[model samples]
Target: MRFLGSRGLIAAAALAGTLVTAPAAEAAPASCAVADAMVSAGNYWLEHGTNLAAPDWQNATFHVGNLATVRTTGVSNHKTLPWAKANGYLLQNDPKRPFFPDFEAAGEAYLDLYTYFHPDPPILADLRSRISAEVASVAQGHDDYWNYVDALNMAMPSFARIGLLDQDESILDTMQKLFHHAEKEIGLFDEATGLWYRDARYVGTGTFWARGNGWALAALTKVLQVLPASDPRRPEYLRVFTKMANTLRFTQRGDGFWNSDLLRPWHYGGPESSGTAMFTYGLAWGVNAGILDAARFRPVVDRGWKALSTKALRPDGRFGYVQPVGAAPGPAKPADTAAYGVGAFLLTGQQVANLTPGC
Candidate 1:
C-alpha cells in the first residue's frame, strides 16, 4: 500500500482531486522539474533490484523506457543501467525460443547502454548476436510476426535502435517490413479513425482503446527517432503518426486525460493515467519533431501534464489510475497502478520537459 513512501503527499493529492482542466488554468511548475521529480520518486517506489530480469515484455518495456527517461532528464546515472548490465543484457527468450517481439524488448535498453557508455561493448554482444541470428532464421517473409499493436512498441524500436547502432541499414529494412505487414496485412490500422485496433476484436467497431493506440503511436515515434530520413519508409511512418495525433487531439477529455476507450468515452469513462501518459509522451515528441502543429498540440500536452501531475500523482510521487494489464478497455479505478503505467508517466514527463513554448 505504501507505494511511494509518501502517504502524506498521496493524501493531499487525493483531496485536491483532478488538478488541471481546460479553458484557463493556473501556471504550474516547470515541465522538466515536474518530470524529474516524478522519475526520481518512481525509481524510489519501484525498487527493482540490480539483477532482476523478466522474460515478458511488460517488465522489459518499462525498464527500456525508464532508461530513456533517465537519460532525457539528466538524472545522475541510476541503477537501471547497472541492473541491465548485471543481467547480461539478455531478454526473456533464449535462442531456443521461437521468434517473438516481446522477447526483443530488452534489447532497447542494452543498445542504449552500449551506445551511451562504450561502442561495440561486450555488454551487448549477447543481445546483438541473438537478435541477428533470430532475424536471419525466423523473419523469412514477415509472416504476421508482429500481430498485436503492443508488440510494435515491444520490438520495432529495438530493431531500429540496434540497426542504427550497427550501421546495418538492411536490418532496419527488416523492421519496416514487419511493421508494414502488421499495419497493412493484419487489419490493425483502422483507416477511418487514424487509430489502431488492439487486435481483431475491436477492428471495425468504433472502439479505440487509448492505451492500445498509445503503444502504436509511441512505437512509431521511437522508430522515427532513430530512423534515417533517407529510408523510403519514413514518409509513410510520418503520415501515420500525424493522422493518429490528429485523431487523438479530438478525443482528449475535457479534464486533459483520455478515457480508456477512445471513441466510446463512456466505456471505462474515467481518468486512465497510462494511456494519457503515453499519448502525452507521443504528442509531445511529435511537437518536438515538428511533425505535429505545435500551436494546436501544445495545449493538449499542457492539459495532460497537469492532469498527470495533479490527479494521477500522489504528493509523494506514486502514479495512480493505471489500468491493470489488459488487451482491451475495461474498468480502471483511480487507485489501480502498475510498473508499465509508471514507465508511461516517466516517458511523458521526459518529452514534456523537452518542449519549447510557442510554435
Candidate 2:
C-alpha cells in the first residue's frame, strides 16, 4: 500500500507489540476483524486507486477523501491531512465543483477530517473567512432542505478548532436560527409520531430520513465538541443532540445499520452506509464526551464498525452501499459513489480508533 505517512503503520506496529501485554479490556474484540478488513481495503485504494502523480487537484479529491478515510480508520499517518488541506485551494478552484453554494460544506468536511492531525493556522483562517462570508449571505434566504443544515453544522467544528469562536459568533447565531427553522418550518418535530419530519413539505407522513437525521446528529455532535460548557447555546445543542440520538437509537436495525427511511424499513430495502457511518460517529462521540452511556452505546459502535467494515467496504477499498447524492432518501444505486460518504465513514473510523487501545 502507498504510504501516506509512517505514523499509522508505526502506531499499528506498536499496538501489535503491546497487544501481547495489554489487558483484556485493551485487546480488540474478535469481531473487530472488520477493522482489519477496513485497513486492508483502505490500503488497497491508496496504493492502486489513488492517482498520487496527478497534476490536477480536483481530480485528486477522491484520493484525498480516501486518504482521510485511511487516517480515520487508523491505517495511515497524519501527513495526508496536511496534504489534503494544502490541496483545498485547488478543490475550491475547480470550476466544475465551485466552492460557493452548498459545496462550501464539502470544504468544511475536508477541513474537519484533517483537523485531528494537521492544525494549520493559515488554512483554518482562510476556511473560516470563506465559511463566515457564505453563512452570512446564505442565512438571509429561506432553505427548506435538511441536508443544507447538515452541511453547515458539519463545518462549524472546523471554525471552532481554529479559535474562530469569537469571530464566528454571527455564524453560530445563524446556525441556531437555521436549526430553529428546521425545527419549526421543516417539521423537524412531528406531533403524531413524536419524530422529526424528513422535510418541510412532508408532514407526519414522511419518515425521518436517515441521512438527514445523520446530518443533524453529526452537526450537533460537532458543534458540541468545540462549544464551551459556558456558551449560552451549549445546553440547547445538547438537548437537541440527546433527542436526536434517542429517536434514532431505537430505529437501528438488528444487523446494526440504519435503513434509508428510518421509520419505514420496507421503503428502502437495505442498510445505508452514509447514514450508518454518521450515526456511529455521532454515537461514539456522545459516549466519549460522557453525554451518553458508554456501556449502552459501545455495542452500537461495534456493530456499526462491523457492518461498515464488512458490508460496505470492498477488498479494493471502494466503499459500496453508499446512497448516491440526492435531496432525499431513496434506493441506493449500484453506480453511486460519493466523496461525502467516504468522509462520514472516516469520521466514524476516527472515533473508533480513539476508543481502541494502541491504535
Q: Candidate 2, 60: how far from true, in Å?
A: 11
Q: Which of the numbered candidates is closest to the native, going by highest TM-score?
A: 1
Residue ranges of candidate 2 with Cα displaced over 4 Å? 1-101, 109-121, 134-149, 158-168, 189-198, 333-336
Candidate 2: lDDT over CA atoms? Answer: 0.59
Residue lDDT tens for model 2, 1-359: 12223433333233223223321222223355435554554555455544443323222334334554554443554445545555653234345433333444434434534343343445455556665654665576744323343443444444444333244566666556656666666656654443455555556666677786777677777778767677787797787778777766787888888988888889886878888988998998898778988887888888888888777877667776778766577887543545556657766765776677645
What is the lDDT of every predicted structure here?
0.72, 0.59
Highest-lDDT candidate:
1
TM-score of every model versus the real structure: 0.84, 0.72
